[model samples]
Target chain A: MKFAVVVFPGSNCDVDMYHAISDELGEEVEYVWHDVDSLDDFDAILLPGGFSYGDYLRSGAIARFSNVMKAIKKAADEGKPILGVCNGFQILLEAGLLPGAMRRNNTLTFICRPVKLRVENNETMFTSQYERGEVITIPIAHGEGNYYCDEQTLQQLTANNQIVFRYEGENPNGSLQNIAGIVNEKGNVLGMMPHPERAVHELLGGADGLKLFQSIVTYWRDAHVVTT
Target chain B: MYKVKVYVTLRENVLDPQGNAVKGALHSLNYREVQDVRIGKFMELLVEKSDRDIDAVVKEMCEKLLANTVIEDYRYEIEEVVVQ
Candidate 1:
């Protein structure tokens, strides 16, 4: 499926996302600048990680006001799959596309390493390939990756089964409940701190992340394929 | 002219690791009386006098951009400047 990787001015992982989609996933992908006013041509939206707007005023705070965000919101309203990684996840939170906010890592340092994550729910489009309770290795790199939300919101997330991924062994960033990834109420939008694109190739590290992209493509084709 | 000063800090329920680290350093330095230390942000804005309500304008700025109400709290003060 065609994907659009939204690129803000300070986004450093845009190329990595593009390479993951175009080369590793072998899918059609394009870099959509932050100023773009429409996402009509893309089938899915990918918000890559980086210090957007230099992480000024807070991570993803300034970037949330970018012109492309309006379109991203509209895309979400239209039920198009939207996946946000790292700072992209922070942007989703700042833009109110996802619940919860990111805070400084409990250690107060920039952490960059491969983290083991447990797939909490495999029913969604993003994790359909994985078995329930499956564990996968993905890399996470961020300073403010701690996720915080009110008790009510956390309960709602649990009730709706929106929690997609959780830390397998140790909570590296001190995220609430060890939540590493989550999907919106509608299940079309996902926000996660780990870098799945970075783990798509075994040469780079491991190919555990490739299944997520494959799941999305497989689910899309299954739902959209025309029956004559 | 008007000078607007804004202060932003993490919400009470949120943990401030930097602030905690600083507090620890202070304790090691023998500052025993210190109860707590919270780090925050400060910004100053200069705006030209206009018919619009300055309070409303600054409030909007703080709500929309100056601070993220989800995890941080913000307060601001406006002062009139005299021009010679």
Candidate 2:
């Protein structure tokens, strides 16, 4: 499958995602500059995590207005698969592809460590590699990673089976319902506070996150347009 | 013109480390009367009526990007005012 990763001014993880997909997974991937007006020639788009725009004007606030995001919004409406990780998750929230806002870590400190996440719903295209309610540990790093949503909306999210991942043990960032990740109602857009790309290689200490990318590849392959 | 003030907060299920730190400080200071503390972010948006269906547009902006209606609640109002 052909994949594209957007590169914002401050996107430090762009290479990581690029290498993980190309060098590691041996998949064809392209890097789209943030200023690009369109997301053509790619099946899936990824907004890898990093301090986009130096996390100024709030983490994802500034990056939300980036040129390519407008294209991403339209693509999502067109049923394209878009994944946002870490700061990418913040950007997704800012882009409104998913519900909930990321707040300052209740501890008010930047946290970086491998965190255990519970797979809330795997029926979606992203996490189908694991059973629903399964647990996996991946590294999470962010200062304003706390997630917030209203009570009723939280209830609606749970009722609709839209939640994708949650912190398995203690809530690290004080995310509502220990939420680590969530998908849009259509399940094509996913935003997670953890860094799955960072955890994709066992040599990196844990391969727990590889399943996410692998799953994406498998799902796209099953759809039959992909070249192995 | 319309002005919308949106306040965002973490839901109860999420941990509030800032709140916890404040609570701990309050107790340490011997001010046990303080029950709890939580922190939230606030945003104010101003849009002109000529900006195209300001109300609907703003609502869509909030839902699409501004506020994460999930853990935060946002309310807005219309007004005519002068800025010096």
Candidate 3:
């Protein structure tokens, strides 16, 4: 399966994502420019982390207006598999792909550290390889990764089973219910504040990120998605 | 013309790490009594539409891009107006 990674001006994880998917996972991967208007060549699209658009007007605020995001929205509406990590997650929230909004880190400093996350749902294509309640180690780097939403919406998300991941311990960023990740109702789009691409190789200290990519490719292969 | 003021804030359950850090720094400096601190965004919008759907348009803006409803709450009001 061909995977496309969206690269905005300030995105720092596109290369890392490309390496993880193409070099390590041995799959076809492409870095799609954020200005591009189409995503017809990719089966799965990844929104990697970093301060998109220099974190102007909020972390993901400016990046959401990039031309490529318009196409991303179309693809998402068409039920294409999409994964957003870190700032990418913020962009998704801004783009309305997922629920909630991101606020500044309560402490107001750039936080860069490894965090433990618990797998909340394994049915989605991104986390199917992980078991429910399994803890995975990944790194989070952001100054605005705090997620928030009102009470009514929170209840709706809970009843809809939209939440998919949570912080394993410490509730690092003060995310609602310790939420680390969430998926849309269709389960094809996922946004999370942790960087899965950063933890794909053992040399990086943990390999928990591999499961996410593996699950994506495996879902396409098993389901015969647009067979070539 | 109508002027709207938008207040954007993080939902209560989410952590405001930045605000907490600032609060801590304030405490260290002997500025106490600040029980909690949270950071939010404020925006002023100008609209020329005279239709009663101003609220709907602003709501759409929030849903489409202005604010993320997943983890944030946003409220707006037409604070001023001139029907020129």
Candidate 4:
């Protein structure tokens, strides 16, 4: 399967995402510019972390209006897997591809460290390799990773099994319900603040995150084989 | 021409960490009377006269880009400008 790593001007993690996919995952991956209008050639889309548009206006606010968003939304509607990490998660929230919004960390400080996360649901394509209730270590770096949604929306998310990852211990950023990550209602789109791409190799620290990529690839291969 | 001033603020129920920090500082300075401090953003836009209604245009701008309706509420004031 092929992957497209969308890169905005201020995106610093594009290279990291490309390296993880190409070198570690041994997959076909390319960096697609934020202004590009087509993603038809790619099967999966990855939005990596960074302060897109310098976090101007709000984190990921301006970047969401980029020309590439049209294509990204189209890809989302087509049921393609899309994983967003860190600021990429912020963009997904801003673009309305996912629900809720992000707020400044309750401490009003930039947090940069590894945190434990529990796999709330492993049924989705992104977390199929993980076991429910399993805890894994992934690094988080951000100033505005606090996720917020209305009470009714929160209820819907809980009912739909959209909340996929929860903080294992102390809530690092004050996210509601200790939410560390979530997928859209369809389960095809996932947005998480933790950097799974950064953890794809043991040299980086832990290889726990490698399974997330493997799960996506496995799901795609199985589905393709079934249909064709 | 019109000079529009837009103010965007977090919704009432949403937590404002920066605002709370500022409020704490104010309380420490003996301004205990201040019960709440909610910080927000202010943006100024110079708009040219157009066929579209100014109120409608401003509202659309705020709803679409200037502020995210999910967590923020926005208000604006417009003043007609006379350029000699």
Cα lDDT for residue A194, candidate 4:
94
Question: CA lDDT of each candidate?
Answer: 0.93, 0.83, 0.85, 0.94
Give one digit per residue, the lDDT tens place, for model 2 in A1-228: 888999988888899899889977778999999898888678889999889989865678888888898889988988778999999999898777788778788778899999899998988888889987888989988998888886777888898898899999888877777988999888899999899888878898888887788888888888867556
Against the true structure, what is each candidate's TM-score?
Answer: 0.97, 0.79, 0.81, 0.98
Question: Which parts of model 1 are misplaced by more than 4 Å?
Answer: none
User: Candidate 1 chain A, which ten residues in sequence have the lowest lDDT sum?
Assistant: A219-228
Residue B26 in candidate 3 has what lDDT? 91
lDDT of candidate 4 at residue B57, scale 0 to 100: 100
User: Per-residue lDDT for A1-228 in model 3, tens only?
Assistant: 899999998899999999999877899999999999899888999999988888876778888889998899888988889999998998898877887787766555678999999998988889889998899899988877777877887897788888888998797766778888999988999999989898988999888999999998899888875656
- Rank all candidate structures by their lDDT, best first, as comma-separated numbers: 4, 1, 3, 2
Q: What does candidate 1's lDDT look like per residue over B19-61, in tens digits?
A: 9999999999999888889999999999988899999999999
List per-model TM-scores for chain B. Answer: 0.94, 0.66, 0.85, 0.97
Instruction: Tell me the deviation in Å of residue A92 in model 1.
Output: 0.6
lDDT of 2 by residue, B21-46 (tens): 88899999999999978776677777
Better of 3 and 4 by lDDT: 4
Q: Positional deviation of A35 in candidate 1, in angstroms?
A: 0.6
Each prediction's RMSD over C-alphas, in Å, is 1.1, 4.4, 4.1, 1.2
**Highest-scoring model, TM-score:** 4
Candidate 1 local distance difference test against the native? 0.93
